[model samples]
Target: MKRSLGTQLRHLIELLDGAVGAAYEEAGLTYRPRYTPVMRALMQNEPATIGHIATAAGITQPAATQTIALMVKQGLVTTEAGVPDGRQKLIRLSPQGRELLPKLQQCWQATAAAAASLEAECALSSTIEAAIEALAARPYGERIRAARAVMVDSGKS
Candidate 1:
């Protein structure tokens, strides 16, 4: 019996996420699934405000704040007062975070290479990215609010 379209898509997502996670783990990196998206955003745009980071990463403000706190405690990020707005905090990679940046790049590169090596690889890459872009095009705050609503309503949070 064939799987439903939604089931197939979900399985592909899980496989892609798992493969990347396993690759990073095998490389001895201590990256969390939640942190990967945030780290990628930070790597692309350093010295951004926490609000901007949260928006870019498509997570709630509190979620971004918590992630930032964890990263700061782990010595991966540093925070300072925003230049123009003293009320807002600016975030950037710490020295240690900067040092780990190259390793992060290498890990992703390895993952990409592995994906390319797989059979039917081009279609796999296209499907994954198109799905990601579709999700990314949605309003981040709305998505988070909806997800929170569902979790709360279902009492499975």
Candidate 2:
């Protein structure tokens, strides 16, 4: 009856995202946490391909593509043909998106401050960072397989 680690992590992320989304709505900003990576990628390097954005945002290509489609629909970004390869499309912030940057940055700062306050109390940020680094060094799947092998050898199922 207990939830898995993945499920618990997802629930925590959803709760945090909901709180941040509510704050954005209250501030009259239409921003969402999901859009942050895309915005940041474009802000840092405009006319970037979806692959480039994905790498810069630390997300998968499919996720970056989906986010780009949504951003395009929202008029927050525009796409143009890549210069070197006309078949490739490059993404950039729209004029509207550019205009919203200042407010977005302010909201980002406030959100960061709120997260910092929570981090100070709970050390959640550092803990999560350490966990990520540990996992990167040795993935959970590797650990799980090794444990399973040991369990089977001991007839523990």
Candidate 3:
């Protein structure tokens, strides 16, 4: 039986994530792949609530909370009470996390360059942005929504 395109796409996503993680490790960084998305979201918008980060990162609230706890333990982020919602906390990168931001940015750039180089060297034929646009133009938002639904169904959210 032939494998479905969804299966192949899933595998490719995993491969890309692993490759990015390896690139960061090669750069002598501890490289927590799970934390990268969280950090990226935070870097894009500081002082965001944990719930906001969870929604933006497409992760469950519990997962986001766990990630934030780990980051706090690692001194990568700090949290304080929110003004509007006293019960909710605002998360921001710690001084150490801020210091590492530039390094992380560099690692991402290196990873992108490495992938581009491999695609060129192997003559792999695929336009990534075009593929993304095509995915985005799907009738029901995108395949990402389907994936997220699976995650939700699995009690992840």
Candidate 4:
């Protein structure tokens, strides 16, 4: 049986992430590759709201919220009520998270170099950027819905 495109894409992501995660382990860092974006966001935009971090990381609000919760649990960050808005919570890295930054920075650079090498080998970055642009113009979900409608109509006919 042939694997779907989504499955293949996820497999590729997992492969790449595993390599990076291994590198982090080698460096004695207990970091998940997925946490990089949120950590970087906190470094550059401390005192940011969940919305800000999500946008800065180009991730969904729920994803950012979940990551933040895990970070808090791991003592990587702390959240408090927003200065002016009691409803909004501001997030920032903890002292431990700040201390981990130096190592994280090294790992980030190494991981970037590794990803660049991979991209050079296959031009994967450009291909992915192009795919994202195409999807922005015409979302996959909309295309799928249209195709399903056509299939249903044809079956009826």
Instruction: Please report the candidate that would top lDDT against the real structure.
Output: 4
Tell me the tens digit of each residue's lDDT in model 2 across 1-157.
9999899999999998999899889889887778999999999998899999999999999999999999899899999999776888999999989988998888889989999999889999888999999999999999999999998999964
Estimate, for each residue in 58-150, the C-alpha lDDT of model 3 and write its tens digit: 899999999999999989999999886689899999999888888898987887787789888864446655675676777445567988899
User: What is the model-wide C-alpha lDDT for candidate 1?
Assistant: 0.83
lDDT head-to-head 2 vs 3, winner? 2
Give the Cα lDDT of each candidate: 0.83, 0.92, 0.84, 0.92
Candidate 1 lDDT over residue span 46-125, tens digit each:
88888899999989999999999999888889999977768999899989888877888898788767777873556766
Give one clash count per candidate, in the order shown: 0, 0, 0, 0
**Candidate 2 local Cα displacement, residue 62, angstroms:** 1.6
Can you tell me which runs of candidate 1 are displaced by over 4 Å? 1-10, 55-63, 128-157
Point out the higher-scoring one by TM-score: 3 or 4: 4
Task: Give me candidate 3's TM-score against the actual structure.
Answer: 0.63
Runs in model 2 lying further than 4 Å from the true structure: 1-3
Off by over 4 Å in 3: 55-63, 115-157
By lDDT: ranked, best first: 4, 2, 3, 1
Tell me how candidate 2 scores on lDDT.
0.92
Model 3: lDDT to the true structure = 0.84
